[model samples]
Target: MKKTVTILLFLLINSLVFSQSLVDLSKREKERRARLKGKTIIIQKGGDPARKGATLKTDPSGLAEETEGLDDLTSLDRESPPQKRMIPKTENPPEETGADQKDATDLQKLEEQLRKAKEYVELLTLKMNALWQEFYSMDDMKSRDEIQRQISETYLNLQKAQANEQKLQKDVEAR
Candidate 1:
């Protein structure tokens, strides 16, 4: 049984190798020619005279004289017209009405908002530092309420800062 299995395996491997060996250039050419069997080769003396004649028929005269009568072909050589003087058109200047007052008012509003936001951020940072100190203190269980309060305050301040930032963006865009 072992001898028969080994012989069968050897035959399979030999057959695979022989199949690959038959795929040479000659076989590829034979398959290509078989596919092109019904096609006729129209070889003229100058090799496909139709394409050459088509290109020649597109323009009888080559590129040089094609533009012969394109623009003012007559050689009269008359004096050209005098160059026209082009005066720049008049435009109304922009009007500036009470811009200074508006700018000052907007500046004051922005400054007040920035100052309030800064104070809120500073308060939040101080609360965070206090919480950190309490956490790292010798008595760990103490001041749990204070730490939670500080975290809540920080979250509120962050939300306020985001709101302020959005307001500032709107102000800039309005300008």
Candidate 2:
């Protein structure tokens, strides 16, 4: 009987608290609306208000008649059509120096190799981590040995990639 009375009292308190919170929110909203009741919003962009709906009025007879004024920009050709500009064909284009071009290409190759080496090192590092995780999760001796070997191989490859990346980086910097 005590438990029933306690549960009923808890439900009644919770309902009262929730209803009071709703009333408080509504009161705040009413106060906010009252504060903004007499306010007005206005946006002023550019341009003169007197010329907002005005447009340029051109002479209708000036369409076909040529005018002597310097501001006359209307051109009407009631004749044939327009012609395309003709370009003369050349047999040979000028060639660039081999040494300059070769050096740029070499630098680009070194940079590309460095980028690939960095990516490979990152890949190998992930592979090494996965190998270690697999080794830790397993209990079989043969599988552990296999994973150890793979870890060693990945470590070696990672070292090689790092060295290659360092060498390429130096070469790129020298260029």
Candidate 3:
């Protein structure tokens, strides 16, 4: 009798968990259906319409008319005359020297490095702010101390990255 009761209890708990998941899945399906209800669906030639995926739909409303403006812009581009070349034809065309190419490559690398450094600083600043908030809301002293140390480290890294970015910017400007 005890074994039977135990098995029944297990089955009841399992059903409860599965039923909750089913309810959640149905809710999500309803929401997805509602979102796609009014949208038109395009069925591919060899594709099954019953398949689950994104369906392309043509806009039948004023939105379609609004896109006609973009079509007109494209048409205008086709109607316009071709642009003339900026460089004049000569017997010997000017070529880029090795040093010029190297300088250009170095400038691009510096610009990219500076952009990465700035992004790093911004990410660090965001992390520091989030850690600060977490530290304030914490009830434990040890956790708060750990979060505070993380905030300090992140802030220091942010300052270093910002300094490096400034130096790279100056180098770029000097060139």
Identify the leading candidate in terms of TM-score: 3
Worst 10 residues of 1 by lDDT: 73-82
Residues 14-35, model 3: lDDT tens digits? 9999999999999997786665
Tens-digit per-residue lDDT, 42-139, candidate 2: 11122333222211223432222222232311111011121233557668845759998788668867876776566556556656777788899999
Name the 10 consecutive residues with the lowest summed lDDT in model 3. 71-80
**How many pairs collide in each candidate, listed in order?**
0, 0, 0
Full-model lDDT for every candidate = 0.50, 0.59, 0.60
Q: In terms of TM-score, which candidate is stronger, 1 or 2? A: 2
Error of 1 at 116 (Å): 3.1
For candidate 2, give the lDDT: 0.59
Please give the distance, in angstroms, between residue 128's alpha carbon in candidate 2 and its true position after superposition: 0.5
TM-score, cand. 3 = 0.46
Candidate 1: list runs displaced more than 4 Å.
1-96, 138-142, 169-174
Scored by lDDT, the top model is: 3
Q: Summing lDDT over every window of 10 consecutive residues in candidate 2, give the lowest-scoring window.
A: 72-81
